[model samples]
Target: MTAAVVTGLGVTAPNGLGTEEFWKATLAGESGLGPVTRFDAAQYPSRIAGEVTGYAAEEHIPSRLMPQTDHMTRLALTAADWALADAGIDTGELPEYGIGVVTSASGGAVEFGQRELQNLWSKGKEYVSAYQSFAWFYAVNTGQISIRHKLRGPSGVLLTEQAGGIDAIGHARRHIRKGFPAVIAGGVDAAICPWGWVPQIASGLMSTVDDPARAYLPFAAEASGYVPGEGGAILLLEDAESAAGRGAEHIYGEIAGYAAT
Candidate 1:
């Protein structure tokens, strides 16, 4: 029996911008939690969040495209580029039917949402950048990733709350098994800012602790609910035959098998 292989990995998490950074922080048991920066906390009940700090869009995003791409989409695209490069696939002319993208994400263009609302209330409709038309949409990450890579093959997004993280891996593995050759697979959730919390604030699933340590603690004795977070990751998935033929390193593991309810 053949196994699906991992050829590339990219991650943007509350810990850091890429897999290296994420790994360093994780190994040291670093806490990424903090007060939200995109807005003032004078009014919101939940002021603290797990914010990804020191990440500059310019460092990860191409200057020309940044003006048009939303923050969430930018993270996804940047991660995708790194993943594809790590896979050693020149996406400039990808195999027509072998490349695909399967990603999971929650709220997108959320920062955009928070800002656009301000524009509407303080400025005018024309003041809204056209990117607002779809920046925060769930499908934007998958769409932008596919477009950047010219995947031209089957592409999809998983919106199953936090379940999306593993769902994306399953999607890519299934696609590879079906003989798709290669697929970019992962999940991203970049909704930790202002508007990201509106629904949660209303739904009462958010934290109320002013101390970052006490806020959004999961699985602890003082466990509250989750903190809204924003970040992205992409892992390159390929058929076993392809990766063994090329010989890549840092192969984390395989898409062995996953279980769900």
Candidate 2:
């Protein structure tokens, strides 16, 4: 049996954009929490959020394509592009044998939610955008990602709560065992829409703190739920032999054993 290996990886975590940048901030214990700039919180009870800083959509993807997609899809596509390029798995010439994509997310099409609600509340029924019907669906990220890469091989999505993101990779590995030669698998999230966040206020999970460090306390003394977070990590998984043949570098780890019980 061929061992599953990670040849290339990318992430858009709350800590930062890019693997290096995220890692640097993470190891240094840097916090990304701040006032919610994406929305005017004069009415909302909680004002703090974990916003992604310094990530320009144009920098990650082309200008023309960015407008047509949601923030989460943009994030996943950008990371997937970088990961494939890093793996040197040039699909431009590869004959269609079998490839796959698996990804996950906690919330979907948040901005779509925000816009539609705003349009309805502020401008009444006539101003609603037509795209809202499909954009807010849970499957948008996987669909957009697969379409962009032309990876029509095989696709699946995991939405197992917060654990869904971690489980998506294992699903990809299973596909490889089932005969897929290559699989792009990972997950992402962008559930910070102000309208969508209205439920959180009732749920009583968010922080009311204005100070950054004191705002979001996940598992510490404060431990009053957690601040919403966004972004994702992707891994390129191929048979160990195939990865070595392609000369991909820096094998991260192996999916040797997993448990759910």
Candidate 2 lDDT, 105-155, residue by residue in tens: 877878877777888999998887766776676677777777777787778
Clashing residue pairs in candidate 1, if any?
A: 108-136, 190-230
Please write out the lDDT profile of model 1 over residues 1-261, one tens digit for every residue: 557888898887778877888889889988788888866866888887766677788987768778667777887887887887777766554468778888888766777777887898899888888877777688888888887667887799888887897889888888888877788988877776657777878888788888877776677888776777777678998888877765655566788987677
Provide the overall lDDT of each model, using Cα atoms, as 2-decimal numbers: 0.79, 0.77
Q: Each candidate's TM vs. the true structure?
A: 0.91, 0.89
Off by over 4 Å in 2: 93-97, 120-130
Candidate 2 accuracy as TM-score: 0.89
